[model samples]
Target: MVNQAEQIDVPCADAIMRLLERYGFDTIFSIPGVHTVDFYRTFPERGFRHVTPRHEQGAAFMAYGYAFATGRPACCMLITGPGLLNAGTGIAEAYSDSLPMLVLTASNQRAELGVGRGCLHETKSQHAVEQQIAGFSHLVLDTANVAEVLHRSISLFLTARPRPAIIEIPRDLLAAPTRVTLETASMFHPPAPAPEAAKMAADLVAGATRAIAILGGGCRRSADAVLELIERLGIIAVTTNAGKGVVPEDHPLSLGSSLPFEPVRTLLEEADVVLAIGTELGETDLLYTCKPYQIPGKLIRIDIDPHQLTMNFHPSLAILSDAGLAAKEICKHLSASVSGADRADREKIVRDSRAKLVGEWSAEAPKHKAILDVLAGSLDRDALICADSTQLAYTGNHYYPSKTAGAWLFPNGYGTLGSAMPAAIGAKIGCPSRQVVAIVGDGSFLYTLEELATAVENRVGIPIVLWNNRSYGEIKDAMNAGGIPTIGVDLYTPDFVAVARGFGCQAILVESLSQFGAELGKALSRDVPTLLQIDADGPSFAELAN
Candidate 1:
């Protein structure tokens, strides 16, 4: 606990860094401005690795990618209103994905707050505006309250449902000395499942004739525990897009992220019991499907957020606990009571569901699958794919075979454009040893394409596979399907290879599917970014597949 009676000469800005250091922050993404420079006074001595993004949006997205890749929050320093507002979309994306981030931004001087006196870089209410997207947005009125407010914000990121915590510091207080005693960082454990709840869930699983498991993003850290339980019970498993790679796609009982597919949805309705872990079972998870998501049988849901237990689909039994802890508890109670005699039957079910999903694919799916096949064969087993909301990525969402958890990064919830390139750069910085690739559409690629300069400046080696379809293909298709005229879907795209070279990155125009593997190989060897543009008109993936 902090004692207000004790005083110190340390500036509030420096105090923040001191506490963040104790909290284990090693990297910061920001663009320094006059209002925020006070926080940088002893930046070099503090030894925090700083990354400067071209735009504030990139800063937030970079932090998001860092957290998503490493499963830990990263810090972002922003200027007053515009900087924070520009980063709003990225922050919202993080919140939607349930990723943790610490956002520190300068607000107007205490005297000018909400005055509408036309102060420079001022907003009417930064706090209220940010509260819509962030988990909580706090404005510090007194320097004495800074430490306690920070502790409260950070605790949520660590011990509860993870989301962005916005701390708005008044510029005038940045250099002010505070007497508040800083508290040493303390760790808090996530809540575990109740003994009764665990036993009830285990009993349901043990008694089911046909049971299945659905994993969500919340299971990223609990993959091993969840896999153990799934194997122990010999049950088929499917994953949402955000939960891809929770179980290796090659596993015999795995259904390869096919939750939204018609066949998988049908199978879920047929089961006698369904175990859902760490998922909202939201409509976004069932994207492109016409049928409303339903759970007709007994549904057992395990989640950290109590409110989420009944959000979309009601559960017969709900356990409010951390995904990993609940999974372990369920496994502990299950023991060796589950017989393995039915393991072969579960494997056959997975195979049949997958085959039916393939049979129901639209004409365009096979085209994207050919390209995905090439990518799957070329990348390393531990490689991470930072994907954008494009036609190719939309297909890969259900089809990509991820080898490990946290290996596939996509804007599934927020559905933002232009996150893949900057996110790939951030992922590389966070995990320098792992291979990172960005698969983006021509339209979305333009969103953060300028981040290529950052990649080159930092000497971060990453391959950006530009899927140039010459238009907003998905939207145009949607319009056509709805009997609407396509208007703004067609775009005049630039020569990406030439633009990339102008930015000092290695660039090439991939002429055919056969040439991509060689170019990607070369890209992986360089210490800077490589742009490989595959034109939609150049060759047909359907023809290649045939």
Candidate 2:
């Protein structure tokens, strides 16, 4: 309980704490340093859980994973200068997927802020550099104004275009006694949809004879609405990498989440109307410069951010509104012009498209089945899985069927390596009831392996599955594709099993494909965290992409 007597003379940093609790943050992922140790010193007694990851980058990724696992904004506190810069990769990844986060940074005193006095943790343009990747970046120049700045920054985390927001506070203010006006945190209520845009979107999709609904990460908040619209309008649904499993893939009308794959491309080609929902049809999703995406039909899009409406393909009708509200409004106004006779044609289109894709997977069943079986056996249908950027991730993301929006956690937008382990640990902490797994490559796993210590110290058990390819497989494949010899890409990894055990996790090394499932089942069933290193020497993803 916060004491009124104590709050009467609360330091600005303590006032910030009161504001944080008011805004619904119970835990903060952070790494303490000289510049930010004062706040850490008083942190534990203030009823806040401080999770200290080994590295600043891991702490940032942990915050991202926590936010993804729980449908709330996560916070990461770091020292200024190097600490803030180290967190750039994770911040960039979260920005790409539009995840909500709060990054609290401690800067030099307000007087020496940009004077280049060579003060500890001093950097010029720290706020500017952070602003480039963050949704909003601001400085708290005064102790009295810290509460207001925190309130504003927290609110932006819940806005329609939710992403990470950075707020830098000067060290001098942290301990200074100040009277800051702190109000009860306002529940971040999103803006309502424009009535006219909703009506127009309803008219566009409700009347189409054959409509295809494409979902992206923006659709996460409206999974139910998307499902309802799909069932109501009898339209086909396909998800993007960022928006995977917004609608359960088990539905008959569902085409599994894969970007620009053959079956989904066919659906788009034949679609009389395409309802692009909550995703910016970015270059990667469209496989642009490889083969441009041309919509031959009426295109309608619903998105919270207006800028994305025409980021890539021009939409015939663009509705700037919350995805859930937009979907419900479209459903309400929709009465498909498609008749009972046209129903057969629509159903056939969905069945044939899904069947063709399944058939292709079946053709390559021998190669992928081992990995799929182990995943199926080890994790619950709704388990949360983190994917590092590597060749292995490309395949799992394309074929893996996630039942819920947050179940598949990939660095979809940033495509960064070394993200899966720390993010996986954060996901476990965020949702302790659910099983969490990190699927990573040997090359990528080495990047954040230090996080294993963080995981063990925190007693967060996340079973990690490493594709031990012993090389930067993607780069090697790219080199071979261009008819160039492999150079610096080939890697030499430490014994991962020994490394995992040394870090206090149950470790298993499986060489044969047949033993993969059994070993995984054992690891996942255990209460403690585990790591299973698989000897993978398959054809590169470049071959699979072909």
Candidate 3:
């Protein structure tokens, strides 16, 4: 409870805390340093939970995970130069995946910013360096504009395309005792669809004999609208990795998030009208395929960003609106024209595509499928699975079927290594009631392995499925496929189970595929995180799968 006496006049840093509370920011992830220690001046008064990670990168990734899982932005407080620099990679990954985050850092004093008097944590121009990663970076010069600037950042996250926003605060203003006005956070609505464009798209979709809809990350909030539109139009649907569970994979009209596969590409080639919503048809969405996407159809694109409307693929009808609003507008115009006759044919196409894709994946990577199947069956409907940029996650991006939106989180665009463990910890922190797990590769797990102590200290009961291939398996495969000599792919590996045990986590080495389910169940009920190590070249997974 905030003291009534102290509310009259407090430190400038404490004033910022009150504003953050008004904006509904209740949690912060940080590793406090001398420069920014004052930022935590009123944590006890404001009732904000502070999670401290070993490194600044872990802090940023944790913020990303919290935001991705709950669809709300989290705050990160860091020191000056090196602290901000350490967090760049995670911020960039958040930008690539369109996650909402607010990063606050201490900068050198305004007088010492570019003067280079060799202050403790001085840099040439910290805000300039950070501008490249965050959606926008601002150097706060005065205490008066703090409320307005923070309001802008929160508004962008709620109403526009979500991305990380950075605020660089000078050290002098942090501790100054001053009075600042706190404004109420307003409700900002997203843009609505244009009627003419919606009508034109409805006509094109209604006239097409064969059509398909591709859902992307932008459709996450509008899953209900997306489901309604697809069911009304009676067309087959697919998703990009980011849009994994927008349309449940178990649905008959759903083709899963298999955009990179040949079967989906073939379907896209034959489509007469393509409705691409909330996703950029970027190369990352169609991984492993050198063949360019050929869309001879009339493409209708709906997105909030105007610049993205003409990117990569040209759209016949481009509507600038929120994905959910645009979908509802299109469906309003489409109800009379579409019939129920084509749904059965579309379902058959999805089934055939699934069969062909299963045959291909089973032949190429049976172990990954076998592992994913077990995980899918073991978890609850609301379980959050955080994946890293590893071979197993690459396969699961398409092969795994998620039943709910926001359930599957992956670092697809930036493709960063060692993200799964920290991200899963953040997810668990954000939604304590739901089950959370991390699926990471041996090569990527080492990137942030020190975070195991953070999980153990916080008692985040997360299950980490470590795929121990003992090398950079995906890079080696790519080099072999290209007939290039393998060079830096192989490396020495350590005993991960022992390492995890040393960090006070439950650890186990699975000898066979059959033991996975029982161990995972045990891990979920424990007080600390668990590390389950599985060898990629171990006992045959095909035998159990068959």
Candidate 4:
């Protein structure tokens, strides 16, 4: 069948912009360069908010965070070659978590595309690089296919698997007169499990002496459905970092996040049956070395990707299905059988495990609870927490409980540092009505410090919480644990509050825990960007190694 096409007498850039806006994307994160200037020029005419991050990589990460935060697909654009390569890391993170987004990158001139004559911004293959990092990648060489290609890219972004999609539109095409036929982007959902499979799984759960659900990133899309099923059945639940907040760590049935914590680890070890959903059960999330139970119990794995069924642990039941649909079906099959004194007894175990765990974690946390206490107390119920990858991030991951799913923008899959600031900026833009905050270590904060300017320019009012310890504390802890002397890990301290103020952000330094709550209150109340820097060691990195 021939793909859709139509002729429109306008620059390719103009057509692309209108098409994206029509497809429900009102905001974009981008960085412009010579090859991509044509598209950037159309931004004013398109009337969409274009957020320009300080770095191309940060732009891509911002886009990822936007989509992850709002449960909506987002878009990003960058210059060709070096710009595309810079976005590779962010694209990989989106791919790992199956975030829905579109990455539109400029390519060398269509005429000079493949010729090795050293054309400006040329690459070995821009499309090829993008293809490896996203769910789908297509090169639009013909101006006629501009709208069609972009629409299709959005469709791919929202559908099956729901990872990022890329469209590489060559620079020449942006100015070329083109045939443009706008098509509404379609959504293709992943297939649900067969009725028999759903029934079998439900029956197994109904009969289990002890059963628990292990949730992951993929389940975020179907959080409500999963939550309903678990709550209705009174089944205890636990989550990986990417899946944290699905059942609300505050919820009594939730064992909270699995890795880098003790309760979920001990509980998983003692379970007679495990029902894993929408996650690869990755090594880091597994906290494999932290525990001794490799295959804790009989497994029941459900995932959209068939390739992941047997990845880490083979399951007694592997159901190929959409997490939400399968969960709904299983709830139907086990409607009346999930309740009883026996189930209540098992649930008490989950509650007991959580209490024991929280009591322990909270004990140590109160010692350094200034940041934690202030954040927990001051956070808006609907706020989004975009956390960087560092010692403090891990502490927040374990200590800060999310009441809503998809509201926690964590750098889990790729574990990249410097993601918190830009991601928080994107989260704020994606859901302007909801508050967004960034929590980062000083080392990671500097990696994307330029974005403080991005936040200032865009008027994004995210409160950034900086843990200034003057060292890569996690790395230093690793050295100490490994019996090596810590060196080259210390960072030269800076006047962070002064720096933030210079960037037009409201800024303050918390010299002691006594000053913590009020400073955070000030930052959160500001309508413009703000920063709170605390000189501290968060949760003791060594505890996480356990």
As a TM-score, model 4 comes out at: 0.91
lDDT of 1 at 203: 89
Please write out the lDDT profile of model 1 over residues 79-101, one tens digit for every residue. 99999999999999999999999
What tens digits encode model 4's per-residue C-alpha lDDT throughout 1-546?
234555357788888887888678888888878888888666787788888888888888889889888888888888889888987888888888788878888888877777878987789777878878888888987887776677677656554677888888888778888756654445556688888888888878777777788899889989999998887667789888888888998887887774545666666677778889998888667432245335467888888888889987889999888889989988878858456786678668876776676543423254334456567777776678888876666666766778788877777777788888888888888788887889888899888898888888887888888877789887787798899989999889788889889989998766555466677667776767888776664343333122
What is candidate 3's TM-score against the reference?
A: 0.96
Candidate scoring better on lDDT of 1 and 4: 1
lDDT of 3 by residue, 1-546 (tens): 222232346776888788789878988999999999898777799989999999999998999899988888988888999999898888889999999899999998888879989999888999888889988678989877776788789888877888899988899989877665544557778899888889888888988988999999999988999888888888789999999989999999999898878888889999999999999888888774444577888899998878889999999989998999998998889757355567777888999998888434533366777788989999998799999887778788888889988889999789889888999988899998889999999999999999998899898999999988888988888899899999999978899999999999999988666788899999999879999898876675455344
Best-fitting candidate, scored by TM-score? 1
Collision pairs in model 4: 7-179, 8-179, 8-180
| Prediction 4 global C-alpha lDDT | 0.78
Clashing residue pairs, candidate 1?
Answer: none
Superposed by TM-score, candidate 1 places the C-alpha of residue 332 at a distance from the truth, in angstroms, of: 1.3
- lDDT (C-alpha, whole model) for all candidates: 0.87, 0.78, 0.86, 0.78
Error of 2 at 300 (Å): 1.3
- Lowest lDDT sum, 10 consecutive residues, model 1, at 1-10
Runs in model 3 deviating more than 4 A are 1-9, 358-364, 539-546
- Clashing residue pairs for model 3: none
Q: Is candidate 2 or candidate 4 better by TM-score?
A: 2
Write the residue-wise lDDT of candidate 2 on 398-489 in tens digits: 67778887788888777788989999888888888888888898999988999999988988877788877788876786798799999999
| Model 3 CA lDDT for position 13 | 82
Clashes of each: 0, 0, 0, 3
